[model samples]
Target: MAGDTKERILETALALFAQSGYLGTSMHDIAKELGITKGALYKHYASKQEILDSIVERMNKMDYERAEAYEMPETEPDGFAEAYLHTPIAKIRTYSMAQFDHWTKEPFSSNFRKMLTLEQYRDPKLAQLYHDYLATGPTKYMAAIFRKLTDSDDAAMQLALEFYGPMFLLYSVYDGANEKESVAPMLCAHIDRFIAKIESGYRKPHAEGA
Candidate 1:
């Protein structure tokens, strides 16, 4: 089928892109990997850039789906610290673990991540994608959730930084092998510290009426 062939071409292109930086790869490489002629490849994508664009689009859809799946509760309970500590903490852990698994386990998803990370420095489009998806996107999403829960944009931003910053750092430093084993505990530990800090903030008394 036309759609199947197009999907195959994209998958092959992504693998090649991941193995060799985008600039390092060529249409011939993708076609050879797919066992298709260059002419056949053109039937699906007008150019190599078009293939990259399609891959980016597909990965972006996956990213949005994951983000939406981790939606925060609409209303906080009677106690802020207690509610967050008990509910979203667990949910966030689950969400983070799922993210780790997706980034490490899924071939297409993981390769897409690697391709973008490697190419971001060289390609402006990839750089923007890196910032939009991996950097600012998660932080902004968390900020919105924290704002709803804490009622303060500043506090929310702080919490987002505390929560996402270390995790992103870990991701950057992560080597391919044993990433889940190596990073899962650290991620959870960071989450624990982050929640403790949030709870500490709630316990602090306001300095006389300002």
Candidate 2:
């Protein structure tokens, strides 16, 4: 029974937080929506900050799981690198866009956007989660390919960003955009060009070097 209550509270809180944000939502709002007293709400969550913490924890776990499935070989030669860059680029982007689309259509969508926008101020720790995850995980893997393909560290980093930066940006933008006409194809094309550019840099100089 206690576990069930916690689940209900979390589900309600996630929905409300995604709609109104931490500041906009009150304990009374949660209690009233749940048809319970403020005291009952406190039994589950001490405060709004605690709720934010829980939400961030859940989001992080979801992100980590998604990234785990998409992991790539960090250091590989041209053949594997090219294949790595091509296959998952489109599929992952499209999957991410679909999730965003689903969320935007929900009543909590506006609040969710506001929380994402204002969350930096409210919880600095949560703000850095996405960057930290990308830098250490997915982006790190791609960076290895970039370094192998381009002798210059700056060039490699730039190339990796060219592929990932837009992917991240498009997921945020396309969540609310039209679904029938999506941005995934265009983003894939741009990434493909980036891959081709990386491949060009890896070619050995023939008589020009000799």
lDDT by residue for model 1 (1-210), tens: 888888888888889988998899999988888888899888889999898888878887887687568763434323433334445456867877678667766888878878878988999988887788788887886776566446688987888898888877877556544545777777778877876775567423321211
By lDDT, who's the top model here? 1
Name the top TM-score candidate: 1
Query: Candidate 1 — which residues are off by over 4 angstroms?
Result: 67-88, 148-154, 176-180, 199-210
Q: Which pairs of residues collide in candidate 2? A: 18-112, 19-111
**Residue 66 of candidate 1: its Cα lDDT?**
78
Candidate 2 residue-wise lDDT, 1-210, digit = tens: 988897677668767766676567788998898999999889888997787677667656655554456553323455555555454545545544544443344433334444665554676664564345433444665576656456677877777777777766665576566662567676657666765564455533321353
Candidate 2 versus the native: TM-score?
Answer: 0.62
TM-scores, all candidates, are: 0.77, 0.62
Clashes of each: 0, 2
Candidate 2 lDDT score relative to the true structure: 0.60
